[model samples]
Target: MEGFLIRAVVVGIGLWLASQIVPGVEFRSTESLIAAALLLGIVNAFVRPVLIILTLPIALVTLGFFLLVINGLMIELVAWFLKGFVVAGFWPAFFAAIVVGLTSWVMSGWIGGPPKGRIDVVTMRQTGPGRWE
Candidate 1:
């Protein structure tokens, strides 16, 4: 879907930004960078929900801070599978996760524009004969 592709690109940009900002995160090539984004999307889509469910109690107990741990764990999983992508350790992955989230949020908001919640006064009808119209 269009939305998914946009999100992948945002995540990819976030990955690149994280690599630049965090010394511990590294990608050997552009191919691996793209692969990381796609893999990260797949992991977030399929694996994250199950992990969240299994670790719900711990996540709740940690007042949702453990979600950051889960995010870093996802990065570790990515590193384990991808040959060129490397997350140095838990802290680096954690920082990368933060970067990814912030980048995605800002990029998506900017690209997608404002939310569809505002009233459009120009589109209102004035065809009625009543005084209220």
Candidate 2:
């Protein structure tokens, strides 16, 4: 779908930004960066939820902070599987994940997807209990 490709491109940009900003995160080329983004998306979609459930107790104990560790680990896992992507250590992955998440959040706004920027608007409606009309 068009939406999916847009999200992937946004994620690729995020990965590129992460590689630039995080000292120990590296992508061999633009192709690798895009592939890393796709791999990250697949890992997040398929593996992250299982990992979260397995680590639920730790997540609860840490007030959800453990999720950040999980995110970094996912990035490391992707780097492990992808030859051209390299993450030097946990800290680098952690920082890179944060940058990637931030970039994705910002870019999602322009992409018109579920993660788009939120705006609240108030409207007046004629009284018809529990109805807009």
Candidate 3:
């Protein structure tokens, strides 16, 4: 779907930004960057929710900071799955996650999509006697 492709592109940009900003994160080529972005989305969609639910107690106890670790773990998992992507260690992955997250957040706002729960309204005024436009 169009929406998925848009998301993937946004995520790809984020990943590219991360690779530039985070020292230990690297992508061998554009294709690998694209693959990593798509796979990251898929991992977040399917694996992250389960991890969150299973670790709810720890997440609550840690005041939700554990989610950052989970994010790093997801990046590491993606690196493990893709030969062309490399994350040197947990610290780099953690910092890379932060960069990617911020990039995605900022880019999504600028990209001009219909955001969730947004509403549009139209109003009309009478132009002449018994006429409205």
The number of the candidate with the highest TM-score is 3
Worst 10 residues of 2 by lDDT: 108-117
> Is candidate 1 or 2 superior in TM-score?
1
Give the best candidate by lDDT. Answer: 3
**How many Å off is the CA of 79 in candidate 1?**
1.2
Query: How would you encode candidate 2's per-residue C-alpha lDDT over 1-133 as one tens digit per residue?
Result: 6666777788788888888989999989878888888888889889999999999999999999899899999999999999999999999999988988888888876655665577999887978878784
Clashing pairs in 2: none
TM-scores of the candidates are: 0.82, 0.80, 0.83
Q: Name the lDDT of candidate 1.
A: 0.90
**Model 1: residues with Cα > 4 Å off, grouped in runs:** 113-133
> Taking the tens digit of each residue's C-alpha lDDT, what string does model 1 give over 6-108?
7888999999999999989999999999999999999999999999999999999999999988998998899889999988988999999999989988997
lDDT of each candidate versus the true structure? 0.90, 0.88, 0.91
In terms of lDDT, which candidate is stronger, 1 or 2?
1
Candidate numbers sorted by TM-score from highest down: 3, 1, 2
